[model samples]
Target: MYFFLSHLSVCDILISTNVTPKTLQVLLTGRHLLSFSSCHTQLYFFGAFTGTECCLLSVMSYDRYLAICDPLHYSFIMKRHLPQFLATLCWLVGFFVSMIIESFVVALDYCGPNVIDHFFCDLTRLLELSCSDTKMTDICVTIIVSIIGIFQVVFVIVTYICIFTSILQISSITGRQKIFSTCSSHLAVVSTYYGTLIALYVAPSSGHFQTLNKVLSLLNTIITPLLNPIIYSLRNKEIRSAFSKNVLRRLKR
Candidate 1:
């Protein structure tokens, strides 16, 4: 699971980096030679990893929900073997889904006005630049995104709602507090991630929202990754204690 997650992270960095913006500018604006195969490769990898990340996040949220809401069966059900199987399945599904969407995207040939307005090679931005009638692409991308992205967000929200409701129902105040602390970090990460994503993509795309969309997109893509580790490490006592112990041992050596 860790390895798959790391792979997704690396892919995200490759696709979302500022280098892509520069490359796109050179290709679209500066009359640089761009091979059709190269563009296809870029779209393939970018979609693959991004789709994988979405599925991985949903899986992670389910894992957290099981751990918090069904603690008694978590160890037995979510063992190392099960996690490995689930992670593999998620990656496979994400890869195929992305391939199908990207295949459709590339099938639409570019005739003129290839200037992409956005920073990265996002499907929507690419569609906007295509000279071909993109009504089909627009509908297709919107449907897929709604199914994959919006579905995952909704699933996480629903699962967490149940988990939090269970936490609140605890009889003892101290038990409730402990449960809240245990789940709070995950909740924070989820809110920050989905909140920004929904604002950027699911909201109405208009000139009025363009600047806001860009700002939220950058926040979700860049800042959220950096903030996730910090939020988890700081709020999680076990992780903090382990880190402190490891540091102390290293210093003593």
Candidate 2:
């Protein structure tokens, strides 16, 4: 789990690093600029990391399901090489899909209307600004995002249902609570991340919802990454204990 978590941390860092600095610059200086290549580069990495994280979260849910649902076989199933393979698969799929989508975006001709409404070079905004016909590109992106998002969400939901069934089988209330606690943080992160993601990408975009889209994008790009570590750490007893000790020491000073 920690191994998967470390990779999650890397994804969060890459995502925030991809989007935040330029956003901060825009906020601080009231201006932002990017060359043609730079913007597309950011867009590619953003899509890659986000896609990877979606796969990772689904993977993690499967991990928890095994741990909770089948303890005896858990170690055997999640062998040393298995986690690595899964992580690698996530990374590869993410990059490959992003490459395909980015190709679609790049193929479009952006003749004018250079200003993007939102903070960064988002896929939808790029499509909106293109002078070329974007119907096909839009349809392709929509299909890709729908498959990725819906599949992951459904997989997580199914795994958790099984996990919950296993937990309920435990006669003790304490056992049930303890088991649920182990995954509640993951559930929280998944809900927040996917809720905003689907809302932003899968839902139909419009002038009426441009501002809402930006807000949702902010949550997905910035806030969710910031929250992942905090959410996980808060679930750790040792971390919480040390945090309390540090707060007390600082208070004494």
Tens-digit lDDT string for candidate 1 (28-123): 876454466665676677667667767777787787788778899988998888888877877787779888888788878787776555444546
TM-score leader: 2
Best by lDDT: 2
Q: After superposition, which runs of candidate 1 have C-alpha atoms over 4 Å from their true positions? A: 1-40, 204-208, 236-253
What's the distance in Å from true for residue 197, model 1? Answer: 1.5
Q: How well does model 2 score by local distance difference test?
A: 0.92
Q: List model 2 lDDT by residue over 1-253, tens digit each.
A: 8999999999999999999999999889787888889999999999999999999999999999999998899999999999999999999999999999999999999888888777889887888789999999889997998888889999999999999889878999998899899999999999999888878765656768888888899999999999999999999899999999999999999
Assess the local accuracy of residue 232 in candidate 1 as a C-alpha lDDT between 0 and 100.
65
Q: What are the candidates' C-alpha RMSDs?
A: 5.3, 1.9
What number of clashing residue pairs does each candidate have, in the order they appear? 0, 0
For residue 132, what is the lDDT in candidate 2?
96
